[model samples]
Target: MRVSPINAACCVLLVALLGAASGAQATSIYRTTDAQGNVVFTDNPERGGEEVELNPLTVVPSGQRAPAPQSRPEASASPSSPSQAVSSPFMPYSTFRIAAPRNEETLQTGEAGNLQVELGIEPALREDHRVRLLVDGAVSQSAMHSDVFMLGNLERGERVLQAELLDASGEVRHRSAPVTLYVQRASVNLPQNPNNPN
Candidate 1:
């Protein structure tokens, strides 16, 4: 079938207008409670229940008038902290504890050092156990025997390491608190005389 040029032009124009209208309607809606305790919304809110506005439109061909990205709410920063995360119901079955290279009262780190972790079961050992170390949700290392897991080449930054202890039944018997290891280059204590032996 032979199509006329005028017909094609009209179809193109129709599509463009529809796209623009849809884009304008696709916006985030914000809600807030009104002074009378009723939920209210407005493109412009003169009073305080909540003021909602579409993120201002911008044209950024040269990246000059780009829109600012939304910032996350302060409460959403970390949902896994001990204070934030809900306590596990299984915690009552087993007691959880973690031993580090340094004392539990304080934590320290070495540049190319190791965090010797020993996970234990309360009331002494009755069954075989496995300990797994997870770094940011990924399994770093798993040990059948309670031994020191080397933490070498730790960068100088705040590192969050998680350790879980599992019993023979493959159930999480215990889990360490998300230990935040503030790693720093270990200060070396060198002997005064390298050549002389006492």
Candidate 2:
């Protein structure tokens, strides 16, 4: 069989594209506890481990789309006073005042991060403050009578962090704007100068 140079070049190009696409898949891990109450997880099939996979979401290819409308089921119920609610009604409060780590978009997964909330009370309302570290809508840390929270071992991915402050009456005093945590995956370390242990 005779093969032309152009045909060989096209074949090479296709193979290269396929290889690149396959390598672009993002890898994720699943965590679970073992029988003895010890954490055990793996990614290799030979070792009886399962691998997790995540796919990237895309809207417009090169342009921004309209913002999605929020469905507020709780906010539309009634107008509750901040001092009367049993506990922050799980609704929106005053504007958030973020002060620490100005750039939340630069956080890397498994890295340390911090957040500071400043109350915007015009007359300095007498309320016992509380703070919580929410990762992806889940409370990872919580504290009362505190204004600053530190986050560590953050996972590699996008997460929404918010702070909810309750008044002395257990009412919603203030809520910080949800900050976006854009965590990047760490690079794989390649062995260098192998067999150098002396």
| Highest lDDT scorer | 1
Estimate TM-scores for all models: 0.38, 0.39
* Residues 1-198 of candidate 1: C-alpha lDDT, one tens digit per residue: 333566457544544444344445753333455445444333333443343334344434665766678988676454455433224423333555555633322234422434555644464544476667876566786545554466555555666776666667866655667766665544435334232234
TM-score of candidate 1 versus the correct structure, residues matched by position = 0.38
Name the Cα RMSD for model 2: 36.3
Best model number under TM-score? 2
lDDT for position 18 in model 1: 41
Error of 1 at 109 (Å): 7.2
Clashes of each: 0, 0
